[model samples]
Target: MSNSDLLDKKLCEKLAQSASLTIGHDVLITDSFGYVVASNDPDRVDSLHEASLEVIQSARKIYHDAAAARKFAGTKPGITIPIIIDSIVIGTIGITGAPHEISQYALLIQQLAQIFLDFEKRQRSTTRTDYRKKNLLREIITYDSRSHDEAAICESAYEFGIDLNAARIAVKLEEIEGRHDDASEETRVHQAKIMECLLRHFDHPQDFVCPQNNTGYVVFAFGLRSIQPQQYLEMLQQKCLCVNSECLTVGIRLRIGIGFFSHSVETLRQSYENACFALKSIHAGIRNSTCLYIGDVVLEKIAASLPDGICSEISAQMFGRVMQAKNRKEVLLTIEHWFQQRFNFVQTAQALHIHKSTLVYRFRRIRETCGLDMYDLDKVLAIYLLDIRHKLCGQSDSRTSSIVM
Candidate 1:
């Protein structure tokens, strides 16, 4: 039965008479959240059944005191005897007759309170464990489709006391071709043991580590001192190679996605994207035993990492031209051709499928109309930056349709 159900006024009555206490003789029983579940006192029965600050305040204070005394986490509910339950004490049994009557029953009231509290604690522990399991599973599912970089999620977990920062390597585990459907739970356990052994070299009980997905899995781990992402990738690949033995092609190929520190979930999402991209690029033509960062895969970092001043100036000039151009296509084609040529026209024509002569004609027209050099480095950079800005700004034309008089 529930804690409230167990708190019987009849039991309190019997206890009170047995101990012969005259101290008010009121008994109250309260829930963990401080709602009065049952009580013998009439005045407190109605409003006390609802939650109140007075009840929560008293309950929390008592629980904290018990905790500071080094009591086990699950022991708080039963520790405070005969003080208050729900809100009104269900078993106060105070002595109204004499001081001796009240004193005699004090110990009995205290013991009963402790017993009830202990039972409440056991109930809470069971509930919490169930909740945690569900939450863990939910988080796993949420991340299943995410890129392998999980630093952001791990950082968030750490903020909540989950401690995910250790040297980490991501492991991609696919089931053996023929055995995937038939893989047993025992096989999963064995794999877990293998991973556990790998971690045993560095993991502490407080460390965060786990496998996600089916028996075939991907897991990340952290250790005291982190190895470079590539080294960690190699280590995982080597271990998987050993596990596969001679059947190399049939065994699951391990691709480890490595990520650095991320302080928040947004950064973690970026990392995950990078890792997945790296995996795709690395596996495509160059399946070497090396760690690949997302930035390195397509040289995205280098291309996108324009100097701030250059980027800003380019943006301004491109937009300015776009705003001024009579024909949007003229501006766009000019910019596209300029970059395609590397600011040179002779090469740009061949790339754009236009005649070189036509390209020269366009370049001359662009310079005349926009008052910028087709050969200038700054002008070229401006065209490239503006193109991107125009696209992002969702403008059909970078220039105005009508020129102001």
Candidate 2:
């Protein structure tokens, strides 16, 4: 029943006897605000309108004193007891014709108020618990599912009392060249320490943290200024080091996908895609422990547009031939000149400060090993694609390692 509806017929009848003691005397149940929520007598019920205002003014003082005293004094005469739920005073109840004997009944009324407040508090608490459970489940599904549904996301937000229009980000941790079990355990301990420390800096920082799977997910909702990605990344790296020096390696090795600031979860895929690309681009001789931001990769926009599968294929083909050459660096230097000269033998030799005959001998050897002549248009196209891949994706200093670039 609603709070107003809870004024039982039996309760009202019992209270009415005290209200009708003398003619013109009426029972008034003013809330903590002194407003008459219900009355036994119609004539005196009208007084509640003004009384309620007075009750509210008085309830604040009474509540304050009670807090200081650490006991419920109950609102005194000319005052009303407040019906509070979850630390909030909803309303007050007052008795207009209560006698000196009724003053003892003040405890009884306060006890009754406590019961109602406790019930409301429990109900609201349960509601909030259910809401968080549902939200967490929905986030899991959204993180895994490839498809995006605007309607479903919005509906979930409505049910959870989340503002769908607010900006949010998804963070994930992926382990590379490491065992999943150990990686999972380590990330849990590490992230817990990191979050605990960082939250102390923010006014209010709370996140929906998914467990430490091989790739764990964390969603944070906050203002843009609260998290500057670059600064946060640097700070996180330092914090991870404090957790353990090994954490620095783990942090560097882990692929972190940061979703764009978005209201719609669908667009988040773009961020994940970028992170994956950056992770896989790692070659052995490159900077081992570096944080790759999607924005930095985007700054070299044309680099990302290369045809899929072509770069790896070209690298593989060129690597095989480069390894067989008598002078690997010299061969690469020749190819570099060839590329610079637009594949013109005479021009390439001139650029390299070498004779045309010597360039021809080098080209002949390259043609023998690679099978396809570099002079041919189709082969030249493939070679060009390979060169582009090496410059954009592969590291130049990586040739000595297991990774050939």
Q: Provide TM-scores for the models.
A: 0.31, 0.37
The alpha-carbon RMSD values of the candidates against the true structure, listed in the order shown, are 17.5, 15.7
lDDT of 2 by residue, 1-405 (tens): 344443433444455454435323433464443445455655544243443454455444232222332332322233245555445555555543334434455556656655754665576666577467546545534554456566666566556455444554444444454455565666556655444433343223333333334333343433345777556655544432343334344452444434344454454434445544444443321123334444544423343476556555555655566544556556656665676576787898998898989878877877776554656655555544454455455555545322243
Candidate 1 displacement at residue 361 in angstroms: 40
Query: What lDDT score belongs to each candidate, Candidate 1 first?
Result: 0.46, 0.48
What is the per-residue lDDT of model 1 for residues 1-405, given as tens digits with 9 covering 90 to 100?
Answer: 444444554544444344333345544444534444444444444333222233344442222232332433212222223345445443222222223434455566666655655566566665565456445424533564356445655655654355444444333343333245445775665555545544553254543344444333334434225666567555645554554442243343344444433333344334444554445444443224434545343432333344545655544545465445677566566666566556666677776778888877877887787766767766566555444433333334334221110
Going through the candidates in the order shown, the clash numbers are: 36, 10
Which regions of candidate 2 deviate over 4 angstroms? Answer: 1-148, 157-164, 174-178, 182-191, 194-209, 212-215, 220-259, 282-289, 299-405
Q: Which candidate should be chosen as best, given TM-score against the real structure? A: 2
lDDT score of residue 339 within candidate 1: 68
